[model samples]
Target chain A: MSENTTASTSPGVPVEDPTPFGWLTTADHKRTGRLFIISSLAFLIMGVVLDLLVRLDLTSATKFVSLDADSFAQSFALSRETLVLLFLIPAFLGLAMYLVPLQIGASNLAFPRAATASFWIWKISAVVLIGAYLGNGGPYGGWANGVDLHLLALSGLVIALLLGAVTVATTVMTLRSPGLYMDKTPPFTWSALVTASMLVVSLPVLLGQIAILYIDHRYGRVFLLGNYGIWERIDWIHRTPQLFIYVVPVLGVAAEIVLAAAKRRVFEPLAMYFTIGLVGLFGFGAWTNFAITGEGADIIDGLEGVVLVALYAGALIATAGLLGLLGLAVIQNRKLPKISTSLLAAFAAGKLVLTGALVGLVGAAADWLEIAGRGNDGNPQLRMTTWVTGQQSVLIYGAGLLGLLAAIHWWAPKIWGRQLNELLGLLNFLVIGAGALLAFVGPALSGLLTEQPDFVYADPNATSLYSNWVDDTGAEGLSALGVAGTALLLAGAALLILNLFISICLKKGTEATEDPWSAQSPEWLLPSPPPIGETDELPMLTSGTPLLDAQEENEEANT
Target chain B: MSDITPTLASGRPQRPRTQLVATGFASAVCAMMMAGALGFYMARRHASGPHPGSDWLDGLAVPNPQFDYALLTLVASLVTAHWALWASRRRDTAHAWTAIATTIVLGLGFINMVMYSMNRMGLEIGSGEYQNLAFATTGLALAIVVLGLLYIGLMGLRSLGGSVGQRGSTSLGAAVFFWDFAALVWAVTWYTVYVVK
Candidate 1:
């Protein structure tokens, strides 16, 4: 038997043998999870800095910082890549890596060595990718381009993602504790399973595309002009379909947080699961929607048309089903607790997901209208504009980031054995929410007027009869709004980080109880910062709300 | 707080068998998905336009016969590697050792044949699109095969030290599974690139 010590008082102190070199070789999921969180946060900061630079450059028509075209493209590409690949997705996966075992009452991940290797591989690949930026002006091939160093960096990132997918998937599949059946698994773990499964299926296409791109770049430019449609097809599949992979797990987070906050069992657990499964299915099934944009609609005919329509219909139905599930959950809550930052953040995420879905419907409608020859000639370009960027921002950054924030807040007690400052948490949530709204909405509004983002620079000497709506006053104002929103977003991120540092490192917050939030999940039945050993036994789960059920039994015994 | 001695019941410790099976399953799934991606790409390319003709494949500078032989050697390696695993599971030490050695030799032969084929082709990666696909598919398979060989070789050394036996059979089994997967991937690549056209 190990002695119990208040982890909050001695945060970061290893409960087990504190060997000096243990950090290097530790396969402890908790420690690995922390490493992932800290590293991904660092990448997030770097990405935010690059984003601010891009926003600053977009502030005026003339280059604010005067970067060369290649440099500008590289910075933009790197920023988007870093945020998506290195930050958002990894951060969610890291949280899952840490929390899933606990939620399922497992001692450790399924493949601890593989989990460790995955972390190191991801970290090393991120370093290599950033290093590639220093070589050859840092991948000027735009976000999805197949240029030389960029292709290499993309491949490295893809390999890292695949490793992570394998580790997380295998862990969720194989490491559940006794009596925790698949149907009774916590929402977050369920989401992680779906996300990992999707990654296994979808990411290989990305890897294959990049492999082809690398080869084309190495040999002759076979794909440079002649085979560009092929590249575009693959890239679209890789990019758009994979967005759900990032968003879906966060949706699970939102569901968990909401259920925890409302202190109620989910309205229809099976229905929710079914909807989530559909989300994953349609996520990949909708690949053709992206593939058939622009000239592809005309080029692809016959059987492809039938496939595209079926996919489109599937995506629409899945989106509707998910929305209905969310709405039902919200309406069926037994009692709402006082608003916490975590709850607010979860709500914000849910709203953002809904907004993204609505925007997607509009985009789909535009595509359909264009295909029907009932819209303007440039409808395809319009559909491909910053409107798409806005939709992504709503889903990935707004929904994804906020949902993660909600999880961090909801699980911080379990993670660090202390509470983040409530005042700071609320402030951060409000600021980030406002920032997300401003940032995404501005671009969406601008996209309504222009066929492409205004950030793309044209030579000053070139004159055309067509008006450049992107550089006009309206677009400029929107760009400025986006920059302002980014500033607020950075401030919120800083505040959240500071709050976490103070709570955990400085030990200023009150010590967390086992069930700090009165949560219903099984993890809350364990000690805060669960004991680090092979003998730590979790109470057998008898229901989805195992902890609540146990508490009810104890109350009955007392009565 | 009460002086409660925390009875740390570290949730279920994973069985070695579970780890082996889990890892093997993951590897098989990943390899199959990779093969599927390759097939999807090939199908799309074929559907896009007229076949570029046999001249296109020949122009890419891939020595089809040598590549085919290398794939055969890879398949042989897989067979011997799995045979070693089977023997180790049954505690047939001498037979397992002999089979592993044969597997290593065949793996080396495969690598040599691939190198010779590439040399005969006398083409850089940048020669053409077909060359690009051919190299990427073959190169990826080759890398996986080499990694499997290295792992199996290390296991062989461990066996010599008398540390690996029934207790370490799971490790040997996983290695066999991985090598078998690599071989299957090679077969896919061979058929897709060398034989399909």
Candidate 2:
């Protein structure tokens, strides 16, 4: 654990300086991962900006900014789609692309070419998706061909994501360092494995959902009902337990911060593993589709309703387990861990995930209760309200982003060869933290306080999008929070974009000293800004914390 | 400190069957997609009742010989797919080429029969719920078949490029895995769409 072991920024070593064109065709995991990260972040900017617009529309409770209800709904749907697929999934996948191979001590992904293809496919499809939305053709879009294009693009995104998941999972399964058993992997890699496997099994169902919608819409719209019907079919992907898939990596990222930033391992690694795996299990949402009996009609019965209840309960239990693990870290450490920006992000992430799960459980149970003939009696009824959307946003936008920001800041040296400006990092975290709270939670509470539906709607009688609910007895306080939250989120995202530019492009700060944090993972062994073919060689690994073992042995030799 | 870069390094012990392992994952994804589509088909069929009159085919003739031929062609292709892998393992280039060629032909044959059956039935994709499911399921199966065929072609080239000795042809093995999965999908689809009905 000595600080003096820092490797100098030697002159002879080849730093990672791949040209721009090389990145387009390269199969190197590091380059591929960087592409996923940077592109996903760009999309994050767009996604949040679009979300802010949606929030404005909701705040005024009408099509105030986006022109018409169809346009507003389309933006709303596309923004949600972009947040999960383009922003959240790839951000972490990008992290995994960079870290998993390094963590597992693999030369490259299992299928390097496939990994390359996955990134490009996602990038192309995302662009096409944006085009489709702009063309007035998405789920609630007015144009027929545009809608078809959107569906096609969405399907391609799903395919790309699934392919990438396969590569990551296969790499972990077959290419781990000797003796680094699946159960013994580092927390972040473990999370990637679980998330990838979950996506592999679950995402294809979404593809199926989109395919049916595509054919139904493209060929004959008679059977598939209308826009609402199409949206409902894909609704389950964004709902509770199902949406928890995106949060699985957050727990992994947080746990890694605890060990690295805390400079100590957890008291019990297995419990943390169970926590990550459980969240992933909860996220297997292929079965949650709302497409059946053709339209608004659903057919939830004894076993199905019971299963939904169990899944929501499972998410709550997993979040609690995560909290307990973090508490264990605090109790085990001799002194409080350093208050780094990454750790702060980790704490915020835990809080957001907890709130998301709690709200999600309420909304899910309320929905299940109604479906199971128990009751729709949760004050204003949260089942089909903005509460559900708010719960997802908390996890996907709030916690998911924070956890990844924590990872990016913690591993900036490895990924970018420099540390992010700490002042900017902390401010970015604060803005995003506060923004997510007001933006998502505010609307979520509206579900209970007011009679709002899940998304923007065009009321026939009322001038605004919302109907009689706009006149409901309450201060417009919650809607104001939504607007404020969006503003904060957009600003927060911009702040991140700025931090990345200053830290990466401007080459802020000196080259990172090896083991700058004195972290004890195998990856920290490689030169900061690792070289072409990783380490020339590594000693056989018999434990999860090989670097820690190496440190102990080095001290013994000195003594 | 003690050249403590003795920590850890990546790159497993020269993994020999990376292709086979990757193919298994890809096959699982393809299988799951089919399973999901089938779920929709089952639900719609259940709602329409066990016995929808003859018009369930969208006022067209029942797909008999063509559907039957498509199933038979896929069933026969599995053997050739296996043969290709077996031949590649033994370094029997002639047999490997023959087996791969035969499987490819069988795959093309299945696609041709499927198209002819749809054409004969004149099944309009937008006509009804069942027709929609039919087109969706059939199109999915066709995509799988085409993908498997391309994989076979790629693996065939790889085998030609490398001499498959004792470790066996990893690429060829993976190709067989996907081809088998394609056949399995056709089996399920045939049973669900034609035989059971």
Maximum-TM-score candidate: 2
Query: Candidate 1's error at A50, in angstroms?
Result: 2.1
| Share of native interface contacts recovered by each model | 0.29, 0.57
Clashing residue pairs for model 2: A105-B10, A105-B11, A106-B11
Q: In model 2 chain A, which range of ten residues has the least summed lDDT?
A: A1-10
DockQ of each: 0.34, 0.55
Worst 10 residues of 1 chain A by lDDT: A457-466
Question: What's candidate 2's DockQ score?
Answer: 0.55
Name the TM-score of candidate 1: 0.85
> What is the per-residue lDDT of model 1 for residues B50-158, given as tens digits with 9 covering 90 to 100?
3555355545455778887888788777788888888887878888889999999999999899888877877567665566666777777777778788878877667
